[model samples]
Target: IPHELYEAADVEGAGPFRKWLHITIPLLKPTTLYLMVIYTIAGFQIFERVYIMTAGGPINATTTIVQLIYQTGFSDFNYGRASAEALILFAIIASFSFVQFRFLSTDVEY
Candidate 1:
């Protein structure tokens, strides 16, 4: 943040929260959106934590796509289905990445 903006807001009697809300948040919107998209993609790939913690036990409630792929490929010995599932996951992530690029490209401001 630039000191001039805070000085200007201070001159206008805006409180800390007000300045944060009206100034800082807007400035950080692009970074926040980028991070949100990145994290969303990463979240979709979650498996190690769930596997290490629960092993998708008790009816496989905690299973993720990666885990599901591993089970399908290795445990069940169905490489085709696992490959299809992986393709589906890839398509989903690709779609989200496409949307992110399209949105950020068009909506960004200087």
Candidate 2:
């Protein structure tokens, strides 16, 4: 965000709240969008932390999709099921990315 925009807002008697709401928030939309997409992808790919921490837990409570995929493909020798799970994971992540972009994307110009 440019200092000049805030200066103009001040000249127009915009209060701090107004400036933050109208200016700061709008300016941050692109950054927020990027972060949301990246974090969503990262979240869907979670495996190591859960595997190392619990290995799907004392009663299989902490299992993530990625860890399940690993167990299905390698441990159980169920490649077909693991492949299907991977495809489902891909579809889910794609749908989430699409929804996030559809809602949050804007023609932001800095």
Candidate 3:
């Protein structure tokens, strides 16, 4: 943060909450958005953790798309279903990216 901003805030008698709410949070908007997008993409592609923990047992409750693809392709030896599931996963990721870009891709001014 620039010293001038805090100095001005201090001069204006703004409290810590006020400075954080009005200045700090606004300044960090871009970083927040970037992290949100990155995490969203990563969250959708999760597989190993769920696989190791649950392995989609008992009813396939904890299965992820990637895990389903693995089971379909290798375990069941059904390449066609795995390919279709992969395509579906791609479509889902693409749609999410499109929406995020459409709404959150606006240029933020400092």
Say which candidate scores most in lDDT. 2
Q: Which parts of model 1 are misplaced by more than 4 Å?
A: 12-18, 97-110
- Model 3 clashing-pair count: 0
Ranked by lDDT from best down, the candidates are: 2, 1, 3
Taken over the whole model, the C-alpha lDDT of each candidate is 0.87, 0.96, 0.85
Question: Which tens-of-lDDT digit does each residue in 1-110 have in candidate 1?
Answer: 67788899999999999999988877777887789789979999998999999999789988899999999999999999999999999999989888876666434343
Q: 1 or 2, which is superior by TM-score?
A: 2
RMSD of 1: 3.0
Measured on C-alpha atoms, candidate 3 has an lDDT of: 0.85
Predicted structure with the largest TM-score when compared to the true one: 2
Q: Candidates 2 and 3: which is better by lDDT? A: 2
Off by over 4 Å in 2: none
**Once model 3 is optimally superposed onto the true structure by TM-score, how far is the C-alpha of residue 16 displaced, in angstroms?**
2.7
Q: Candidate order by TM-score, highest to lowest? A: 2, 3, 1
lDDT, candidate 2, residue 78? Answer: 98
